[model samples]
Target: MQEIFSAILGDQLGPFGPLILMGTLGAVLILFTLPVLLKKKQDPLDRLRDQIKTSKDVANGKAPARLRYDNQKGARLEKYSAFLEPQDEEEYSAAQLKMIQAGYRSKNAVRMFHFAQFAMGLGALALGLIYALLKSAQQDMSPKSLVLTVLLPGVIGYMAPKYWVTRRIEARKEEIVNGFPDSLDLMLVCVEAGQSLDQAIIRVAVEIRAGFPALADEYEIVSHEIKAGKDKSVVLKDMAERCGVPDVASFVTVLIQSQQFGTSIADALRIYAAEMRDKRVMRAEEAANKLPTKMTLATMMLTVPPLLIILIGPSVYDIYTLLNETNF
Candidate 1:
């Protein structure tokens, strides 16, 4: 065990071991991130649509070898999805909804998340053990510190994937909230141009890709559902739930009311768009108003010490010099 730890920490295997470890890690990171970096930013719905199309091609025996391999990986992930998910129907459905809101609507996404959590936990535990072993050989550390070094990282690693997913959900919501009004404006324009609500939505989805891809993608899904003969209110409600945003839910509620009451849909959208823009401006102003408080600590850390030294440093220096002269 000591020898293994030494080799892992590069004491026995020497510099070459660390070099190899870093190289392997770099390669793994590159492999994981390269495809993501290379692909143009696309909406999740659009990506899913493409994935569905690819699956259809494979079913028809027209997919390439690469696509076949991709499909196999997806299937393999799906097999493990049940392990991450609860067996209880109610709890599983809730967890699934949370995953969807986090832009993880792919069937295998939760499985992949669980896999990542396990991998990270094991890796952290291994690294922590290696660290503890190496340090114990070189110094007399306390048992408490050793235990903490090993267990803390293991716990954090296990939780990291879930934390990251939560952050993704928050970021997705923020993006949707920020871009929603512009999308509404575009939809309003289309509606005023004599397009039906469904047609207007499709147009807005196409037009808003550059500015707000996520919202545009949701709109695209709405269009597809409508075309598939789903009730607008039901589909829009689904979108609101999937997004998990109060603003979107309220907007959908407005649309449903307009439809139910046979009100002027275009006028309703125009008025709602104005309200959204105002709300966005208010949010911005609120953030701006809080900037000074947020900056206070940083300002003190950077500026206060220098000001104190400038004010009192010279007097202390003078006193030291005088006392030295008097031999006090």
Candidate 2:
């Protein structure tokens, strides 16, 4: 293979053909094998054991192991977090909020996100530089092209993490929006059925997991926080912020006000759930109303040109044939 590579690229690559080929093969081999080697191995029963332990801990009114593990991981990350996080307090908080809203609530979430951005950008820059070098060696590459080749990938890589987080946040918001009304209805039922607000929240979280895991997960967090003896208002408010949904914010306000002004919780849930159902209906109708306008361009692009050709093609062909006859 070395001889074959050298013979094939002896002129272009000169004496370095085998070396380049060997390096490429090594890189490819590492690319294929590194992930498998780096992946942490877990026993098949590990998840079951963790689940059983967590259930027992929760039943015994103790903090779950998962939370402790997360805290420990966060502490470990903190030691090297200087370069892994934004220096600006506001930016750090914003990034953390974004991460939470995107369904990542680990304390190391911000650090990991920033690290991903740095790693991706650096890797892309290196790859671009390697490509530029190779191309320059293989053939002439204009300076503008070279600069673009070296910089474009880095810019895109630097922005990719943010782009992904933004998309995740949007997708989570949509899920929460779509599933929230049902959750509200269920919560209302739970409240009406004589369960306390906390139990109702936990019940809703459990029930809603199949259809809308994101909203369910948020409810579960709210339930856990409430169980942990956090101020209910603060917990609700934090949930609202983490969700970043207006409906959720309004729901939180309603609960807070109901508690403050001595209004009935069941009544508030009933009213809010009705409103949410109505809003869901309205949203569906709005989407339906906009469908034709959204489809108009597609309709024209797909249907009109072929239709015109079908209608006018014979006439145009006849005219062309007549012109040719006249010219001849």
Best by TM-score: 2
Q: TM per model?
A: 0.74, 0.77
195-309 per-residue lDDT for model 2 (tens digits): 9999999999999999999999999999999889999999999999999999999999999999999999999999999999999999999999999999999999999999999
Cα miss at 155, model 2 (Å)?
Answer: 1.6
Give lDDT per model, in order. Answer: 0.82, 0.87
Per-residue CA lDDT of candidate 1, range 1-328, in tens? Answer: 5556455674543433443355447756865785456455568999999999999999999996654345565665554454555678898778778888888777666567777897798688667766865665566557587768667887989999989989989999999999998989888999999999999999999998998788888988999999999998999999999988899999999999999999999999999999999999999999999999999999999999999999999999999999999995
In model 2, the runs with Cα more than 4 Å from the true position are 1-80
- Mark the regions of model 1 whose C-alpha exceeds 4 Å error after superposition: 1-71, 77-82, 137-141, 325-328
Query: Following a full C-alpha superposition, what root-mean-square deviation does model 1 have from the true structure?
Result: 10.9
Backbone clash total, candidate 1: 0
> How far in Å is the alpha carbon of 222 misplaced in model 2?
1.5
Residue-pair clash count for candidate 2: 0
